[model samples]
Target: MSSEHERGDKKGQFCSIPAKPKCGDCPHPKDYIEVCKPTGWFDHTFKRFVNAKDPFTFEKKFEAHHLVCVAPVTQILLSNDGINSVIEQTKWCINNKDNMIAMPLWGHTVKWYCEVEESISVDEVADVINDAMKAPKFKNIPQHDYDHNCKEGYTWEVEVEVEKLADKVKEQGHKLKGKALEGKLNKLSSDFRSRLLDDRGTRKGGTHAAWKLAQKEPPDPDWCQPFSMASDSKVSSKGFPVRVFNGQVAKWVNRIAKAISSGV
Candidate 1:
């Protein structure tokens, strides 16, 4: 394994990324995956709020690999160059048995409450989070996570954490939603998710709540068009009205006029 601390020039060890990198990944996606980041934020630096930012953490793609990549985002460097350089130099120190040097070029920092590779779904990464870290003797997240170590006064809100974890699991089931709009719309909180989703909904004039939309349901083919009306009708032998609709409306001008005047 590469020594995270021992590199001669530690300048790029944790590259100071620019506002937006070439890679498309973001710790904050246009629509962040819900539940994963929504819950379990234990504030260490400032007064905590519901859904406050939590320190990022992730399980590496490979068991032995330490370096991983994410897509572009606010904190990533101007490009992948800085992280690429760091990865190259680190390869010399670590065995890099899995040839993970390519990740820096393709990914970004795993700097959210939770994250995974550029292509992996949050569900996949989250599913094995426990198993992947267990054998490696890594800490469990949110509660036991060491990234944002809790001091004596730092509170562990079990109820809030449990809510977030449950919400995260429920969010994974909504993979059909666009990445930009997954978990940001809980009815309960006015945190970032609610705010971001509401703003996005207004900006695009779309339904703010994703679940309220029926994307899989077929469109009403005749919607917005006038409903057909029978130009003429007669009593059938069975006593049911025998109606025929025709496009020759002028033939029934007086009737059509009466129908239109009646608000039919």
Candidate 2:
């Protein structure tokens, strides 16, 4: 995630000049530079793991492996610097031709993924992406004194092995009602993945109500996406000044994962 210079701490701040400038809209560009697109649209995304274990019996349309997704959940920008950082990051994805997705309310591209060669199996995709996150570029962002606008030191990402999780689900027994299985997988989602689907897809009055309601009613088959959990959820607000979002480095990351995990 990127950040902006604090409004109060306007030390080296300049008016945000918006345009497709060479600066790529970085908060305060040291020099005009452009983010390079990667080799190809597929290359831009780092294909993460997919569940290839025993198939989820609930659905026959698409197998478990086909439905399981491992898209990277880009961090939320709590500060101005964070905002700038995500903007730059999204630019990098677009320039690189990756799957750049913009979400509601937040108003920024927050998720990215890769498409592996057709020959690659789900397990292989999982292995490759899991390894890729460890690269120098994808490693966790640590807060530096100069990262002035970040709420905390840095945002961290979690790599979930869908196949392994699926294996566990099988071990736990798959003979369950649609709702029971959905609940079981949902519990796992809360522990691992981003809760964007849980919040936006299942809620009635949130920003994406139309999109959520458009889907078929009742039990959601996709365990990894929205778990078909009910709304009535109350999201606890965690602003920057709020202690819930202060101090500890990973505090905000955890809070973000939890706040969005409404259905779970």
Model 1 misplaced regions, further than 4 Å: 1-148, 151-168, 171-176, 179-264
Quote each prediction's TM-score.
Answer: 0.15, 0.18
In the range 131-231, model 2's lDDT, one tens digit per residue, is: 54222221121111111122321112121333343344345554432445334434444442233333423344332222122222331223112222111
lDDT of 1 by residue, 55-157 (tens): 4433322111111111111012113243333232221211111211111100111122112222344444333332341211111111111111123111122
Which ranges of candidate 2 are over 4 A from the true structure?
1-97, 106-200, 204-235, 238-264
User: Which has the greatest TM-score?
Assistant: 2
lDDT of each: 0.22, 0.25
